[model samples]
Target: MKLLALQGFLLIIAVEMVAVLVHQQHIMLWAAGVAVAVPLAGLRRLLTTGDAGSADGVPIIDEPGAALRQWLSGTEARIRWSESTRADWDRRWRPTLAGRFEVSSGQGRVKDPAAFAATGVMLFGDALWPWVDPGNVAPAGEDGPGPGRAVLEEILRRLEQR
Candidate 1:
């Protein structure tokens, strides 16, 4: 910008000098104004226009991972909410975890209910089976704290292994 301003200043000086010599001391305010206006307009455009090749701005490349981020955010919220209350554990965390565990013994998809339970038990063990059993939802009026972060983290770790 400094270089551009310098060049513009030189341009204006050259134009004014030419006008003086050609017009014989007869000042053409209109011609001087034109010269001044051109550079100022260019400067304004340079100031406003973004660079085509610059990498200084925030990137616009988040689109591809936007859905993943959204899902992770929602899941994180659910985890926090579920950990906050027993109702949320049964309503949100358990159901989601159970839903996430619907796989066959071989880690393939499973549709049968018995097979789902068996697979879940095999993967998460008898202790965790109730917590992530699709057929289970805590009875109403069951309100207290759920398994906290440590348990949740363990469940997630176990789940991720498969």
Candidate 2:
């Protein structure tokens, strides 16, 4: 993530430098436009691209990416535990699961460990919710499976049905 941010920054700087070298005010404006547009485009893609299924219905888990598939599987397994309380849930679970996933699947380590772990925990929470509270219902935005929780929920549902 840091590398991506740095690369984006550098790309912006490069565009600005080129605009300056050309002495084009319009080009500078164009550079500024790109500077604003690229990240927003990325953000949009991030926000829109993830799973978008409702918790009331079955979630789709058709991700073709092997690493992502494994991550989803690991997330589902971690959440099925009922004996462990949230306070007692181990923080190391994410990294440990991710590591094992990396090894078994031959996928590389997550780029951002903290972010990955945090996401894993969120996924775990979502998956465990149905088991923890059968009557509990997810809210509108909260119910849809998206890149963050959605993908995990979908995978968990699939696993549970299996």
Best-fitting candidate, measured by TM-score? 1
Residue-wise C-alpha lDDT for candidate 2, range 70-141, written one tens digit per residue: 998986666543123332222323333344433443323355555443444454455543332212334434
Clash totals, every prediction: 0, 5
Q: Give the Cα lDDT of each candidate.
A: 0.74, 0.50
In candidate 2, list every pair of residues with a backbone clash.
50-147, 51-145, 51-146, 145-150, 146-150
C-alpha TM-scores of all predictions: 0.49, 0.30
True-structure lDDT of candidate 1: 0.74
Model 1 residue pairs with clashes: none
Which portions of model 2 miss their true places by more than 4 Å? 51-162
